[model samples]
Target: MWADPNVRAVLVLLAFAAAYVLYALIWPFTHCGACGGGKRTAPQSQGRYWRKCGRCGGTGKKIRLLARMFGRNP
Candidate 1:
């Protein structure tokens, strides 16, 4: 029941676990560091425009922390 302390503790634990799992799964597709996630434009004064992201290789996806830690290439 809602009044049970054990139930409340379990619910909190479950919520934290779920959050962690979600973060791990979706952390890879965050954004491109070079392109600023495709939101900003490159400087025109430098005579360069629409260049591909160097870090993410223009795919706009980053390597997940969990994947790198597990020795898997992203």
Candidate 2:
């Protein structure tokens, strides 16, 4: 299976995307809480401000893009 052209292409893409997200998540300056520069008075951003919440990790953005790409939601 690994020798297949399609399989190799997909594995390469998945590996690259995973590496990017891992780098983004591990970087110290990536989280908002570490930088400390945003106002958390808004209702939507209340719990997500400054990397306070574990769900969004201060970015206030969902990681649903990959889920959608794979035709699944959770």
- Candidate 1 stretches with Cα past 4 Å from truth are 1-18, 40-49, 71-74
Clash count list over all predictions: 0, 2
lDDT of 2 at 25: 50
Q: Report the Cα RMSD per candidate.
A: 4.5, 10.2
What's the TM-score of every candidate structure?
0.45, 0.37
lDDT of each residue in 1-74, candidate 2, tens digit only: 88899999999999998986665454423223433434344577655543344544545344344444554443
TM-score winner: 1
- Give lDDT tens digits, candidate 1, residues 8-40: 999999999778767776564567666766544
Give me candidate 1's TM-score against the actual structure: 0.45
What's the true lDDT of residue 27 in model 2?
A: 41
lDDT of each: 0.68, 0.53
Error of 1 at 41 (Å): 2.9
